[model samples]
Target chain A: MANKADTIISTLITRSRKPLLDEWLARQATMAGSGAIAADGDVKEYCTRFLAELDTGLAAGEVGDIRGAGWSGMRELLEEVSRSRAGKGFTPSETASFVFSLKAPLFALVQREAGDNAARLADELQSATTLLDTLGLYTVEVFQKAREEVIARQQEEMLELSTPVVRLWEGIVAVPLIGTLDSNRTQVVMENLLQEIVSAGAQIAIIDITGVPTVDTLVAQHLLKTVSAARLMGADCIISGIRPQIAQTIVHLGVDLSVTSKASMSGALELALKRIGKAVVERKARPAAEVS
Target chain B: MDQIPILMVGDCLLVSIQVDMHDQLALALQDSLMTKIVETGARGVMLDISSLQFVDSFIGRLLNNIASMARVLDAATVVVGMQPAVAITLVELGLTLSGIRTALNVDKGLALIRRIIDGEEQAFDRREG
Candidate 1:
């Protein structure tokens, strides 16, 4: 409480700026060499800029908390590093090493500054280690959160890309589900299928689940719900692409799929056409083909 | 105090519900539709509920009652033009409305009713059994 801004870190950084940059860059060059970020990155520029901002933050005498008013610039710098590194596919360690690598050069400076005074040496080293550890851990937390946001965005895009309701015929529609069917996805699928049925006036719908990897009881229940909703809107639903395995699973689960189901999409289509009083017949064979 | 107009097209009575349906409106519709079916000797009823964006369990039961009363009056009721959202809501509420016939639109609804009336297509059987 009596001392303010009389810190060893400000003195240590102000004097040993060049040595700190050189050692930090050297350590960074060997960090998981040549996997994600390139060796000739602008790490030099960041080292210099971070040193300058950090020197100011330390001089302001609020080293106990990096989130304090004194360290706004340093915090912003770490956030920038996190965002850019996350976009470039940097792993958690690689991103966090940007801060952690500074510790070695800093401790060495503390070792030199404290000289023969053993008590001062321990005190400065303790403060330095605590500050660097806090900052390094903060970097890792930011990087991890950034990566999670990226994953969440990709998941949303995949959901949008996956569900597409196709009009197979004048009065028929098909939805080919291709991934794991969760409750969220089932809601999207059911809404899309029912909307298509109404807009296209599709009397029959063929739900081709050939690409769906598994059909557990929950998925089967979702399917039944969609069928019931479609029927309420006066559109018949025909589930096709019931591979032998899925069929076995459905029967084993004792899920009574009372609606009409066919083994393949074409079979479903054929039934839908027949229900609508239409049939696809082969054209008359060409005379040349007949001769062959 | 608004009444849903029931337009009689030939032998089919077309009730296109273009307004919001409350409990009072539903009961009024049942009363008026029952009276009209008895008077006109209509063989079929088509309910166009495309404009209905909301419904509760009571309205669901009202639809079932309307269909049952029409069948007793010797008329087959085919509900048509039900919005997709309304259909999903009804299904989510666990009401299948299995007692009534359903079609895509007015043209198809009329065709289904005619087929049932002429003994071509079997009307959906709703009974205690």
Candidate 2:
């Protein structure tokens, strides 16, 4: 029963492939305010490839279950299109519309092929609509997955970029944290700071939190854990960049940071240098007038 | 019965735990460490746990007990060379090891112990003077 309907739909798509591709492209071009901004050649190529795959997929008689072996080629093609469009900055709806716009041209062909037979036209229309709708929704699903993967990778990069540990002196290193300290980011921050401490053989680490916007109890606890971990590594940690508001918040929360803290990075550096028995002294500026 | 060795270096006793220590072995280590501290009159104890990958609350409590015992014996205890994962795990397990000093490695741990002993000597000298 399904085979008969599949055969009819396959014949209609294969016979009118070019006209179907042209009509779909024409509709896409005239569709106002989609804001897709894709090149005309690219859009036409996508439509042509999609129609060819559809012809093959419908001929295989597995239009119902896309996961069936016969539909693998079409599925792979749609996955490719969805991934590329996602990378090319196409919105989900815009990408799905590529598959959706075929309905109009396809329905017209089904109507012409069915002629005056109401039952045949209804059957063809139902099968075509179901197949196209499944393919369209598949593209959307792939597009969403691709977008999520891109976002996850970008988030990892941001986590790494935000927690940079710089060696300030021979025995001192500094980590300037710049975002909210969640548990995951704290793990990164702790690992980076500890690894730097080992490589630099640093005796002191100055964690500057000036860029962090706020300090709740959890943030305070994470900071203390970092300090404790650094202390366990034999490197004393001095927290710098405690603004007046953060200080008030810390006190109000009654969280004992317990470690030495300073108002600024420079102050922390000075104390770090003092602890290491090293002093940064500016060479007395030679009489400025002598050179002039 | 395998025992973790306690080597005496200068005025400090160094115990390098190279095996995955069990509860019984840890308690035995505590006993041996205390006995050695008294016999040798060591001024400090340094436990190198760089090779220990995981430490549970039992080992954590044993470490605290060792530190307290050393303190009562008038000796300072410094735990050195803790891996980063072990440190994080210890923190997560709520074992802060407070009252026990820690160093990054053996060399620094020795330096820390020497400084404490030297400071004590200076204080003693000041009292005599």
Candidate 3:
């Protein structure tokens, strides 16, 4: 009786073998490809073949009914494959390699569809490409753009300082400012002026603001710093050029300019000469103080 | 008095900026002038404010900021052309700029700068020659 019970159990387990084997094979394929199988039309064909094999096996008492499930069974198999692959880990190098390898395929796709839509595609791909680079999955061209941006910013910064200075006369130095003045550039201007005044041993420095478009609080602060620095070097600095609009704005901002010695470019020139104990003798002019 | 024109004479940046006594053109001038200074890399700055009927705190502060910035950038800043009335106004306004260097006018500013730079160059020449 014990032998007969054992035999019955063995027979029941045997009957399930074919179905189990079929399920196992489907799982293996899914594990190998991840969800990549769904991207291919060939996967459907493969599934059909698998089902046919399953059916033949079951009919022959070797897993026959499994194949009869057809498309539904195949779809289920794909879903399982996708899920299995989703959990896999990729090393950094592997991920990088994968992204790099995609360059050829991406380029191919672009070339094929690039006839009328290249520009749009390029723009769309730009951000994605940058994102990938930032993630360390960089393509060569994307890396190049990042490099270019860094270089440009460096160049702009370099321009702010180390601008060459030229001396006009004894005890007087003039700095002609050009272009726009932002907060950062203003800081640069302050530093350069102070250093030059000290190093060149200037006694009077002229700052011409004729090219300046406008002045704000920050800019005003910059001008003040220059004056203080010059004074520190025992130099008298002149600030010139007062545009009509700018003067009105200064009053509006409620800032004062009491300690700064300013003049028109002409007056500043005269002051420079006077400071050096020299006075210009005009042919038919009034007193030195009555020019205006 | 009219708006001053900032011009580059040799190493001396001649700035004849017309600071409107009652306007905000000074701020505008700062913006444009800074852009040029950064671009052209002028050695020194000269400001002529004869056009200004009054000098206020705002202009004074900007002048100071420009000076400090110029020093950091290895440039010199100078203010030229101050009208007597404007100077008095600036004093009354209690606006005191710390680092801004001033001269009388463009010529004076230029001459001072030229002399200083020449002395340095002569020293450099003595060293290098």
Candidate 4:
């Protein structure tokens, strides 16, 4: 015998598909407060597509077990909707409500169809609630995963964009660090600085931490490691941009940088040039009458 | 069984590590370098390690041993041409390589040794005068 709830739900969905779609969309708009962000025409199309997929899914087999092969079409459609809305900045509740709000209209149809029969009405309502709840939670799961992926990608891009090694002179390179120095970012900074040192054959490297907001013991340790590495590569490292505040923090934290430091980039550059046996001298001015 | 070659340049000994060195090879190089320093009465030693892409703690310690041995034999040692990656790896491995002089390349290393020897000669000449 065909499951009574599945039979009734399949028939209701086929016969009252349009009314069910209209009612569900209206209810979702009010509940989700999504009218400002989502267009009415787009909402209608989504509701229509979801209802068609539901009808096919319910006709395929038992409605209670959503994980079964019968519900694949509906599951795929919900995943698509959840992923797109996640990228669009939709709140978890608003996205899940797209599946949850269908409950009211669907349960009402179940009640009207199974009138004067308490056991039949209860069984149908239980099945409908279970299937819809499963789909709703699945949407949330997919949405959370999608959002995390986006965050991870953006963090990687930020790491790459932040750590840039620049060639300041013929045999000098500089890495101007900005923002927080975490272990992952430190790896990128070390790799880039070392690679540039090899390619440029630089003898001096200036690490300017002027944009670094604060320096703690860990940050100091990372700086020391980079300096030591550069020294090993046969290049002397000069740490510039030692603002008074950072210097105080380093002293207070009892972290020894053990490398040459300067007050600013220009100071460090001057030192780098001197170490490489080069000096930047001011050009002598010509007499104004010589041109005439 | 391959031995690292140590060439004599003027009064200084030059050792360029061109192949990957195992523990035995490093020890052999150190032994050969010490004998060369004594045999030639060398005033300085320049070790060019640009071709060495990696150095574990064993190799790092060996380099330190060579420097210390050269110092005991009255020869100053200047390590030259270390690749950046190798340096970073050494530092990461917690070997600071303190008290060792280093130069950017072979020419700079030669000049440094020359300056050190010249300064010693001038000091000796002042005492004699």
Give Cα-based local distance difference scores for all models.
0.85, 0.86, 0.55, 0.85
Listed for every candidate in order, the interface RMSD values in angstroms are 0.8, 1.0, 9.5, 1.4
Clash count, one per candidate:
0, 0, 196, 0
Instruction: Compare candidates 2 and 4 on DockQ and give the better one.
Output: 2
Q: What digit string (tens of lDDT, one per residue) describes model 3 on residues A64-116?
A: 12223433443344333332323233233432332233233334443444456
Local lDDT at A108 for model 4: 90
Model 4 lDDT on a 0 to 1 scale? 0.85
Across B1-129, the per-residue lDDT of candidate 4 in tens digits comes to 899889899898999999988788889899989998999999999999989888888888888998998989989999988887788778878998987888778887888899888888899999999
Task: Tell me each candidate's TM-score.
Answer: 0.70, 0.79, 0.36, 0.69
The order of the candidates by DockQ, greatest first, is: 1, 2, 4, 3
Residues forming the 10-long window of minimal summed lDDT in candidate 3 chain A: A1-10
Regions of model 4 farther than 4 Å from truth: A1-80, A101-117, A177-191, A210-213, A290-292, B1-54, B69-89, B99-129
Q: Clashes in model 2: which pairs?
A: none
Q: Which candidate, 3 or 4, would have the higher TM-score against the true structure?
A: 4
Q: Score the docking of each candidate (DockQ).
A: 0.67, 0.54, 0.03, 0.50
Q: By the lDDT metric, which is better: model 1 or model 3?
A: 1
Predicted structure with the largest DockQ when compared to the true one: 1
Correct interface contacts retained, every candidate: 0.86, 0.53, 0.02, 0.67
How does candidate 3 score on lDDT?
0.55
Residue-by-residue lDDT tens digits, candidate 2, A63-162: 6778877788788988988998899888888888888888887788778887999987887778778888999999999999999999999999998898
